[model samples]
Target: MRPADHDELNRLCKGVKKSFVHLETRDSYGTEVELPHMATWRRGEPDDFAWLGWWLEMLRGHRAAGRTCRRARVVSEPVSDYQRWTMSHVGLFTDAGEDIRYVARPRLATVPLPGSGDFYVFDDELVLFLHYTGNGTNLSFEITEDDRTVRTCREAFESVWALAAPLHAYRSE
Candidate 1:
């Protein structure tokens, strides 16, 4: 990496500090998003447009902030080629210095599609409402002075992250 590249990388990691909040469920990837909040339950299938669009927006936002975001999905079953493809697209952005991240950590956490999760970026007071449900899933959120929930959520994310496998670990067909 060049000098600028190194600086950018530093900035990216800086976004994830001790205060980032994250919410994931038992069916982390399968939970249905309520279109209203970022919590998960149980679900049938993944919403293609919603999932894809969320990835796109997240990548753009992270890129805008000069940082990278890594995702680890622990599913009950193996992911399909199509699912892998969607994930790969996010990975491509990381190649462009956008810091894209994805992983398949089976059985770690589960959240139904259309559920909600929040991530609070500590340094900048950025709280991301992550809703993975509905036709046009929205991660509607607000920044608040209360950091308790955010802190807990971030800890949860780290717990899952610790157990998650790297994207390269899985060989997609």
Candidate 2:
């Protein structure tokens, strides 16, 4: 299937009935919406983080509905500047009911991961593989309902999750 746009992806996420699992393997992402904020952080300026309100509300709603939302980030030691900036505000996501974890890249040497870059598995049935440019710009999402693909992604994410530390406990050293 062809790649879908962000609005369509968000719609699919909102329709998730049980769980949402996101696996991020990139150390840096150059998203248009986030770059400006990241720059402000780099400058040591204060950000109220009001821009995250919508996403936070979505997470709160998902939690209220008894749905699970989790993200696992596989990062390198001495994480990239982008990761450092992201970690600084990760508390907001956790507080809003998203479970975010981090796994050091070295720990995954023997682990099997999907050949794709990053992906989101919805309710263990549907998978949305994210495509990105070399510079970390998000391109599009390729979705699939193939059972084998779903199972592989779910297992891979679970394996990674098992080795990850909750953001609060991870020191990133």
What would the C-alpha RMSD of candidate 1 be, to one decimal place? Answer: 11.5
Residue-level lDDT of model 2, residues 1-173, one tens digit each, is: 56778997888777889989999999999999999999999999999999999889989999999999999999997899999999999999999999999999999999999889699999998899999999999987898989999999999999999999987678844
Candidate 2 error regions (>4 Å): none
Task: In angstroms, give how far residue 148 of model 2 lies from its true place.
Answer: 0.4
After superposition, the stretches of candidate 1 with alpha carbons farther than 4 Å from their true spots are 1-68, 74-76, 80-82, 98-106, 109-115, 118-124, 132-136, 142-145
Candidate 1's displacement at residue 64, Å, is 12
Tens digit of per-residue lDDT, candidate 1, span 1-173: 01223233234335454222233332333324333122211233433445445445655665566554554444334654334434544454445334322344443446222234433344444444444444333324434434654454555666666655545654541
Query: 67 in model 1: Cα distance from truth in Å?
Result: 4.5
Overall local distance difference test of candidate 1: 0.42
